[model samples]
Target: MLTSESRRRDFPTLDGRAYLNTAAEGVPPLAVGEALAQYFRDKQLGMDGRVPHAAQWEAARALTAEFLGLTAAEIGICSCSSEAYNLAALALQLQPGDEVICTDLDFPASSTPWLQPACPATLRLWKHRSGALHVEDLIPLLSPRTRLVNVSLVSFYNGFTVALPPIVEAVRKHSPALLGVDVTQAIGRIPLDLRGADLIVSSTHKWILASHGGGLVGVPKDRAKEWTAPAGGWFNLEDAFGPGSFEAVKSKPGAASFMVGMPNYPALYAVRAGLEYLRGVGVANIDAHARPLVLHCLTELRKLPVEVLTPDEPDHIAGILAFKHPKAAEINARLHAGNVHVMNPTGRLRVAVHGYNTHDDIERLLRELKAALAAV
Candidate 1:
């Protein structure tokens, strides 16, 4: 049974703050905090002299795979979304004259790797129509030489959700181009079936309620054996490290091949703890609870002088709502003064309401926003 939790008891950070800056970073619940403390204690005690926490690391990978409705073989644990994207970029081995399609509205983290000088591929940028990603526009851009089509599942700048399945099907039907997705903003906040993307990369910091240096990458079964990470490390080796001639270090099969080095066990523990909590509550329940608050915020913001960046339709909304206000800086400062936290990125105030956020938080934010607008 999925119940709505319109309270702040689960998240301690919301004790005195509205904590609407989830797109910036998430506040872990009490369980993740305790897990981190235990990790530190184990490290200080020098238990097993290191490498003893390998099983826990495997569990984290399994949890991530389960969250995405994938097999354990598909998940690769990386430090951040950028690292995962880079791994995907290397696996494709983009040759000269090959083309890669991406959007101008997406975060640079998704596009920059393709643009990097290391790959000689031609980068094609498609402008988002009115800050909204239109799947139809890509029909003209894709060609037989298109090696990859990269896109963000959600716009970090404007909170606009991209309908990915249509685009993914379109590209796959025409060309052999791989669909790479940056889900840093979408994964934990939205319901993702993972049907379209061949390579999915996401950082768990924002919506997963985990700390930094923890991210995940997904590769399909067909691409698993074909993909090999550019960089090699011991963890990727199929052979064990102890009492062995280190001359032959073979990369592990599946997405684990991208792990350039030892996995971050400490951070992986925190990731597991947070992921466990989300599962307990159920993602559909979380979306059902948080989305209403976003709609409420969008409804009120529409009544103001600000220009709404997110789409007006219900299906288009996730956990974020961004609005362009001329007094964005002033309004942000005043909102901060009033203990309401939000992000002012790209001249628009980006408000992210998570599953744990309460209705009171939305009400307080609106009241403060109105006052700040008047004062400005």
Candidate 2:
């Protein structure tokens, strides 16, 4: 039940503009900015006398865990989504004969790591079914040799929220391949539980609305023990001194082992602020507030000549609504001129809604979009 008025003043950009670009780069509120400033100031206080506080890092990670319905042990702080993906790719230890299936609709960060030479895994890029991701399409691609399946929980191009529960059930029943999700597009915007998946990764920038360079990877504590990938920073090990020799080191337990170096203090503080704000506002309430706005936009957008790429079904709808037109990029450019900020992701126009947005923002976007489309 957190309204725009309660949080609008926290975001400077929301003064008189429609910022429907949370998918690309979330606008950090004044709290996050102040936290960032305060972090550097405190860091300078110690000068050469202090180390990064591990306890603060854990608190921030716990905030993320609660937001995602995961445990702290399952969360491994990462510098970015690419880093998280890299850790997952290494942990899988795929070989020449091993096969990994990924959907073409996912962002490159989710698919490229498994395709690296180190893994040497056969890559299968499953095509979308009827312009959307479907379990039926992915099921046919899985086989016994499939060691992993990479997918985006939500599509960045079309704003399609991939229904994960059914897909996970089918994959586990049919193939030995483990499921991995890139949650960059859907984490804070939707409800996510990591109970059934093998692993999941996310950057704090998008839906969590935090520092851009911060990320985390989630894996069960037992799975973390069996991981083969060696993230080589000294701090990643539990015993860096190694009793007498550095060779005797072992990685810290669970996802924390994935932290290769010192965590960025500034980003960590920003994450704490962002996560605290979300906790106060409530993720469920945010989802309820945003979904109606997106559905309203989708319903009204269909009246225009543009082709809506995102599915209208309840299973597929998310905070994002993407539309395609011959002059999509031009229309978005004009919308920007009119102070309506939407994304031109490739050729599609994507409007992203978040907790801080108001119904009036979407109304202005529609009015501006109508004018922009006509002008284009």
Candidate 3:
């Protein structure tokens, strides 16, 4: 197991407070802040060419690809995962009368773009059984008209992790549907091999511990040519500068073709630094440290009057734990008063535990929760 002492040093925020909000937004390390500062310093020195910018951008892409087990060409940088979904929705060749299936449990960012009125597609909602999108429940909704299936790898509210391999197989067997996944909740917190889906999208702000502007889209090599470039710009074409470039250049293959305009270079540098920090403390090691804390939180919540919404088994668990109390709103307010940060989505108090959290943190939260509950 990786040493918690060293891991805690990466995030200075943990020193002052008990931060249990990684699901909403991860706390970036000091190294990332230092790297962003260096980027601005370089920009002040008169570096203004595509080569230097593209090299930094490409290096970020390469590091992301290495983590996701994909080629650099398969990755595209986007402002956020929401934009990634919009790109997918626009680029997909969805004809009129086609059906696109997604879960009711998905974050609005994943569902709203496809459900837009102007889009020539019908949106189908899947039922959630105990926070899980079961294949049996979804299979009844799939029809010959179904063309795509989009689902979140983990539910944001209940922290229920989806079993995607069988769902992907069913989609392939039932119809000629494309599979897309919103892995924003599952990327760095959980072990993910994205080979089951055709298109995958995630934002680095959540689990990867990066800034807000960093996101990624991964596309399979075989279906690279099917989706058109959603919004074209100079970056989408080869030989962007030469004379007759517009006439001579072709769209780069795979998801990289979706990239347009200049990306936030400093943000990319910070994202790379964050990934490097995760790499130093191996992902499995991080998981070992995190899973126990989640279990501890769940165990403590079960002893209270509040209902535990997250799964009980370790296999179905992630870094997030959410529960509902009769006085959830009050509990959230009291926790905030105690300087314990967590997520309050609707009525559910979402507690996102990360590597920096310790057993004492869980004990403190439980003590505060009991006090808050007693007062209510």
Candidate 4:
């Protein structure tokens, strides 16, 4: 089983602090740094490093495919989650009278693309009730006019893990809409059965413990034929040609069609290292390790005055635990002063735990949080 003691050495950033902010930005492992260094070293080598870098990119894509339980052909690497979402939005090619449903709790990147003037679709929000989104609420919003339904597999704001299987079943029954899921918050932190989603996207830097500048997009084989590539370049084309010889071109099959330009090689290399590390530890084991900690945090927080936004049920929660407090920003600064890291966005505080986090880390956060709350 994966344990904090076994994984702590890989994350040197935890040496003098309790890092409970994987939700905001993950701290990369030592191996990821070494991977980036090696990328530069390899770049300085034979043939201007083109062959080696291309191979590394392909390897990274393959590793990402394994991580997401999708085939390599179904995966495309891009700059970030927003770009992935944009690609998905463009591919849908919504027409007038088409409606797309997004949750009110969604990060703007997931829904804003559908609201652009160029997109002819009407954007509808599946509103959350009392800090929670229910599948039943989403069901009524779905209809024949719905062309796409975008949702985050896990709520970035509150750590609520939306029950996707029910969402999938509901969408299949109520609408012809394709399901697009933002796995940015859930990826690398939980076990994902991605078969239900037609398209999925994530950034590499969060719970994956990688660097920024790279993102993942996947389209399962069964759904790949339904969309067209919005843009194309030599990397995505079936036939390569120089500027003078340019003509109409066709994209390669599946998600590879989304790779419109050169990839972020350095970030992709680090992503490969991060994905490799997670597979080595096993994601299921990581989930098990986190469950008790989440329960403990939830149980303890109930004794405090703050409103727990994350559900107490393990089925509805993941690595993050969020709470509402008017003094959240102040408390976040206090925790930072005490060398305990967490995220405070406006009125809520979010603390995230991962494979490298220990019970001691949670206790440290609790102690510091109590002090900070009292001081506030």
In terms of lDDT, the poorest run of 10 residues in model 2 is 47-56
lDDT of each: 0.81, 0.80, 0.80, 0.85
Comparison by lDDT, 1 against 2, better one = 1
lDDT of 4 by residue, 279-339 (tens): 8888888888987888898899888989998876778888888998888889889999999
Instruction: Give candidate 1's root-mean-square deviation (CA, Å).
Output: 2.4
Which candidate has the top score in lDDT? 4
TM-scores for all predictions = 0.93, 0.94, 0.94, 0.96
Question: How many pairs collide in each candidate, listed in order?
Answer: 0, 0, 0, 0
Give the residue spans of candidate 1 off by over 4 A.
1-8, 45-52, 240-249
User: Which candidate number has the best TM-score?
Assistant: 4
lDDT, candidate 1, 1-376, per-residue tens:
1233324456655777787999999888888888788777667767562654666677788888887778877888978887877777777777889999989868877888877777899899877877787777888888999988888878888787878779878898878888887788887777788786778788878998888988788887777765667556777767747556366556676588778787787788888888888888888888988888899899998998789888787776788889888889999999999999999986889999888788888998999999998898
TM-score of 1: 0.93
Colliding residue pairs in candidate 3: none
Report model 3's TM-score to 2 decimal places.
0.94
Model 2 superposed RMSD (Cα): 1.9
After superposition, candidate 2 runs with Cα above 4 Å error: 47-52, 226-228, 243-248
Mind giving the per-residue lDDT tens digits that candidate 2 earns over 215-325?
A: 777776656654434667766777776664455656676577678787877788888888887777777889988888988999999898899988777668778888899
Order of candidates by TM-score, top first?
4, 2, 3, 1
